[model samples]
Target: MTLHEITYTIKDIQGKGKGLFAARDIKRGECILSEAPLVYVTSNLQEALKSIFVLSKKNAKYFYALCNVHHDISFEFGIMKTNSFPLGQGSTDAAIFRVSSRINHSCDPNVHQSWNPKTKKGHVHASKNIKKGDEILKNYIPILQIQEDRKRLLQENFKFDCRCSACTKPSSERDLIITKVNICTGLVKESAESDPATAIQYVREVLGLLDKIGGICKTSYYYDGYQISAMCSDYSLAQEWANLLLESYQIDE
Candidate 1:
């Protein structure tokens, strides 16, 4: 959606500085906003610095207005580190978007953000139903991390302590579930070849654990299901998982 057509608006949140809030009630899987990056950066500091210097006057203003928590670092690098999102998983390249960068963090976020390579734009979709005027939160770190790791990473990288629902509540139960997910995930990979049936069972366990934690991003797990089913020559189950993988991957598209 264009800036004017966006479903969320930037607003000041108490204690959280600036944040994005739903302009109207949004349904699950609905696209909230999509925009091309205002600045692109690589891993190299000097190259990224050059990219910021070359921004248009208006774009430069927008970039400068973004929050930079890394005050101890170079001004340009600090903004890049704080605001940019990786182009994709394991990608060394990242992009800084004007609107998406404004979304604040939550351990249990109501929205999911994805980079659409085909459209060359970043898209944010409602992971669950969001009410009008509610803050549109997104997970800044891996969703499966325990509370302690989540807090440590946020403090070290973003220079803030999170008080989101996930952080404020008791974490023992949550941590246990996440630990189970990691173990099941490892088992899924290990048994996928030699024991396809067992691998499928582990995949379901992982998905169940993720569901218990309100995670809707299960594309990778579905892909593993598909791969193992196909390995065992179960075309029916493989097709089912393939469809699930496709639907999950296209949620933001």
Candidate 2:
């Protein structure tokens, strides 16, 4: 059986410290990395610290090798704070991986990261065609947040200022798009129960806005459209939305 060759490598990035980079040209939607965590724990400080104690000597060495940007905290906790990724949406727990944690942040990122419950691993996929040697970045915060809010959150949590393409450019245009998406998202929620058709319309609006900025999270919106249509007894449109939702999901898979 042929094995898949690794497509990424860890490299030292100027100003950004260490970063994940493409080792070869990678197509959009390609799975770049799928890795199980070295440590997984609830976000509670004591629980997380205790979890680290059970790490084997080799694994403990690997964990400590990862970066710790928060100098004020104890070394172990600071490393956890800096490198852990949330297990899933709304998850109270997180996982720490060796190479995946080396990925740096960009507001306009080229990769998407998700937790796979079935496989119990974290997956990273290329969201855009990445040239060999290009750094693979992922958005560390919600993509829809405006520039000021993103900056504030990044600085407060991650202790760094992002100068990514999205942040370095004039943010007025992107901020306007973000505002439109937020407005449409609110309308979708508000209208879903009383006006299913209108909710679908707002979902489409959200999808379009996302497409304008690389279609970061369209699966959820497509599912929203499908659910609302089905609830309203619009079988035809519901099926269309369902197919779209599946296709969007499979791309990430």
Q: Tens digit of lDDT per residue, candidate 2, span 86-205? A: 988888889998778888999988988889989999888887899999999988888789999999999988999989998998999889999999999999999999999889889988
lDDT of 2 at 33: 84
lDDT of 1 at 100: 89
How well does candidate 1 match the true structure in TM-score terms?
0.95
Q: What is the C-alpha RMSD of each candidate to the true structure, in Å?
A: 1.6, 2.0
Q: lDDT per residue, candidate 1, 1-253, as tens digits?
A: 6643658888887777789988888888788888999988887878888988998999999999999999898888899999989999899999999988999999999988899889999999887899989999998898687899999999999999999998899999999999999898999888888889999999998898888888655878998999889888899999999998877776633
What TM-scores do the predictions have? Answer: 0.95, 0.93
Candidate 2 accuracy as TM-score: 0.93
